[model samples]
Target: MAASSDAACPADPPAIDLRGLTKRFGRTTAVEDLSLTVGRGEVFGFLGPNGAGKSTTIRILLGLVRASAGSATLFGDDVRDVRRAHRHVAYVPADVSLWPSLTGAEILRLLERTGSAVDHEYRGLLVERFALDLDRAAKTYSTGNRQKVALIAAFATRAPLLILDEPTSGLDPLMDREFRRCVIEARDRGQTVFLSSHLLDEVEALCDRVAILRSGRLVEVARIAELRRLRRTEVEVSFTGQPPDLTRTPGVLETQDLGDSRLRFTLSGAAAPALRTLASSEIQTIEVRVPTLEEIFLEYYGGQDR
Candidate 1:
């Protein structure tokens, strides 16, 4: 009998589920009390700074490394017993290595042997889509090209779940954009993608939800829309006359003169009061901009464990 689609998706379980997952390297605790849930077909961003345990968490989920405590499930099976479940999942690590003696085609063939069934036509399409030079030996490929090979092989599997850790680390801007497009297409095709990166802009652009980790602990998990809403806005104003006093404004955080009657400032908590202040000023030009994810990270991670 043929295997059912549920077998491919493993009971239609959440793509990733963890509870109090922890990992230790000798005396160093790499992950601590981390828990997260990623829904099927959702692009979930796992974010943190270096040594914050993001990679360790992904490794634990893949069963590449055992957890020191707690439990994790991928596709409804225990993380430690995911040999079958792994067939439904694909992983792209930050640092991808390919054998110098093999060609791109050879590497992909090996991957398919360990992964799900492959379609030659689909593989060709992936090669073209990723602009890979398959005829070249692995030793000839640059870092960015090697990353492309990894991405192509993983995505070509068309698995139900993808665990990508810094998958675009070596790509240029254009390739990065292309990679994101591919991920978007996969999500539309009902594939779940768990993306781990320190790049907040990437997270903001591709993720439906994000989980922030700090010093091996799960700090926050929120919808991307909600996190964007939580972000503060920046308002800059130029007055025809002296800049108005903003210290008394309810939402205003700080104001600095930008010379020639212009003032730049940041605001949080509420926007209404800031708008009112701007309206009352002898304003020549007023600009209000939302904080980028990087700016928000600096604010949130300052003096903290992230």
Candidate 2:
């Protein structure tokens, strides 16, 4: 029997979805009313300072810690449905610990056999590229080497979703770049990567969108460009003549005079009026730079200690 054209196809679900997620331990609340969605093939950045409940949120998604409220779903399956959701997720924790007696190769083999859907060919390349010594025991590896093993295994799994929590904390500069390359490659392969890292520059480089958390609540979720638009720009102008009067100028927040030629000021909102003031003088040089992700992160986490 043939199905009719009117038959409806199932709609694809997002890679990760949360609705009014919350968690509390006894008297303290860890996460509160947080909700977010990470679409398939998206590299999403989760950022927050210490004690911001980032770990609690992740644990809820992993089903390691139960949420006090709301729900978490992966690919349309509730996170509580561990069999289905877990199968699609490969996770790398902030600190990776393995069986001391197992060699790197042995550990990888076990991970594959556990049904993470490892691509053997890709695993071999990762082992070589990450410079992992398969013959060495896990107990003998340095912090960086241990991270390499975890990263290699997780990336090789080829799971539809990769959840990395500060995965590059132990890597050196060179290896850091390598990790970034791997993340880019993962996104290109249409794999979803949920990266929780304190590395603002790394997030800015790799993430299509970022969600910032403060205390137990979500503060902002936006693309990098959109986030930048909400920030103030720093402007510096070197003049050949007396600095033009910027007094009572719209959009100018703070102004500082550097020597007799250079002036620095912070600009918010529109810049056209400020630029006109700078142009009135014989400008020798000018620098207009947007705030970095670190600056934006500070804007959210600064002042109040939690």
Candidate 3:
């Protein structure tokens, strides 16, 4: 008799569903047998390097491109029946396509008229939150300013679903924080956000779960907390005199010496033992730092610093 294997259960009323979704251009297979689900009101992050079919998958989901094989359902409606579900979903692309001649106010009015009723109060709040100068013409704004305009327009609406592709491309650090706040606010209001971005940190900060793709293949789907469990912490200890030998610590991966009476090493697991070890010694100071999303991104992509 063969041994039984654990089978993953299907999601209950998925917010977004793709089963065996495949796309092809002549001989090139853009996406192959990709199946995934996102729960309602969850901020799901799609992560991948350049040309990893991220855009292709998004285009198919938006009904902008036809899939060669398989099916997609957004909010329980068939992909072919997109118009029915599209009203609930709003998409912000990497390259915003606002009319160059249109003023910020004009573009906002147009998008609002196309979709459901505009939330004037929310729009005003977003303009102020993102620090967007609505008086400027679309063509005259800088990259960051243009990004602000797009963000304000997309987030101002009370849409149930938001599909943002590289949403914060040109924003400064402060604006990025504002963007995060907006996402959180939307999630709190029961809105589901599907974000595709190269900025892993933003994903780590904002997404409840993240799906990593490598070479058009889905490599990993993990929760933010679970992914953080896989993170390594760097411990730096400065000694009043000579450094104590930390060669025997169980989770210690490596250790190095700093010229200024300091030693640094990495711990693959908990920092409790490392802290205990340092406390026992005549340490002047100690610093512990966790791995950033960028570092984790490099590791998952088969880059160095593993």
Point to the candidate with the largest TM-score.
2
Instruction: Write candidate 2's Cα lDDT for 86-205 as tens digits.
Output: 988899999999889999999888878775788889889988888889999999999999999889998988799999999998899988998998999899999999999999999999
Query: Model 2, poorest ten-residue lDDT window?
Result: 297-306
**lDDT scores of the candidates, listed in order:** 0.84, 0.91, 0.84
RMSD of each: 4.9, 2.6, 5.8
Alpha-carbon lDDT of model 3: 0.84
Pairs in clash, predicted candidate 2: none
Each prediction's number of clashing residue pairs: 0, 0, 0
Worst 10 residues of 1 by lDDT: 4-13
Candidate 3 per-residue lDDT over residues 1-306, each given as its tens digit: 755677676655777998988899999988887888998999999988887889999999888899999998888887777788687787888887678998888888888887755579998998988888887889998888887777787788888889999999988899999999999998998989999998888898899999887766777788876676697778888888667677887688779987888898988767677677777789987787877777777778776522
> What order do candidates take by TM-score, descending?
2, 1, 3
TM-score of each: 0.86, 0.91, 0.83
The full ranking of all candidates by lDDT, starting with the best, is 2, 1, 3
Stretches > 4 Å off in candidate 2: 1-11, 245-249, 276-281
> What are the per-residue Cα lDDT tens digits for candidate 1 across 107-150?
99898899966657767887887788999999999999999989
